[model samples]
Target: MSEHKKGQPNKASPEKTHVENTSGTAQRARLLERLQAGPIDTFTAIRELNIVRPGARINELRGLGHKILTHRLTLTDDQGRTHQGMALYYLSTNAPAQVTA
Candidate 1:
């Protein structure tokens, strides 16, 4: 056993790199966590995560290779206000596949 040089790969050990966001971190984390329990809708996502631009965020996630499913749903609100909106669904049962260029 010997000490490895800086910037040199340790052939014996695998390498891992983790990147985080300063702002969108919370939204991304929340989305992933909640997706495990069940699917989440656009309105709920925006309200709960305080996401100013959910479309952009969803696009970013899609770019990252997340298989998010979206569908239009007719829902009634707390006051019985009914409306049609898009619902974003993520299946926690499916494992995340690596994105390939």
Candidate 2:
């Protein structure tokens, strides 16, 4: 553990850390599965998959050596509202396998 000022509160509680790690892992797995089946947009991920932050999950998968691509496009939501500069995530066919240490 890194040392902080005497009055500073500890931010990394064991329970919070465990919950965050589990949530991130689950979200990344769900996103990867969805991407494998087909492309998923930000709105779809939020509405359908219950992933509020799809970009973060996608980045986590990329860090694990998955070749994920993003396509920027304008999209319409369920209420007919148009959103500009949206991202659609796709898994590339040439994604490399993860190397074991």
Cα error, residue 40 of model 2, in Å, equals 0.6
Question: Any idea what lDDT model 1 has?
Answer: 0.57
Report the Cα lDDT for residue 80, model 1: 79
lDDT of 1 at 93: 56
Q: Write the per-residue lDDT of candidate 2 for residues 32-74, one digit (tens) a residue.
A: 7778887888999888767888888898789989988777779
> Residues 1-101, candidate 1, lDDT per residue (tens digit)?
54779897432211111122225645565565566666666777666656666666667667767766665567776677888865555553532343111
Candidate number of the best lDDT:
2
Which stretches in model 1 have alpha-carbon errors above 4 Å? 1-22, 77-80, 92-101
- The residue pairs that clash in candidate 1, if any, are none
Clashing pairs in 2: none
The most accurate candidate by TM-score is 2
Q: Over 4 Å off in model 2, which ranges?
A: 1-22, 94-101
**lDDT values for all models:** 0.57, 0.73
Q: Quote the positional error of residue 41 for candidate 1 in Å.
A: 0.6
Query: Per-candidate TM vs. native?
Result: 0.55, 0.68
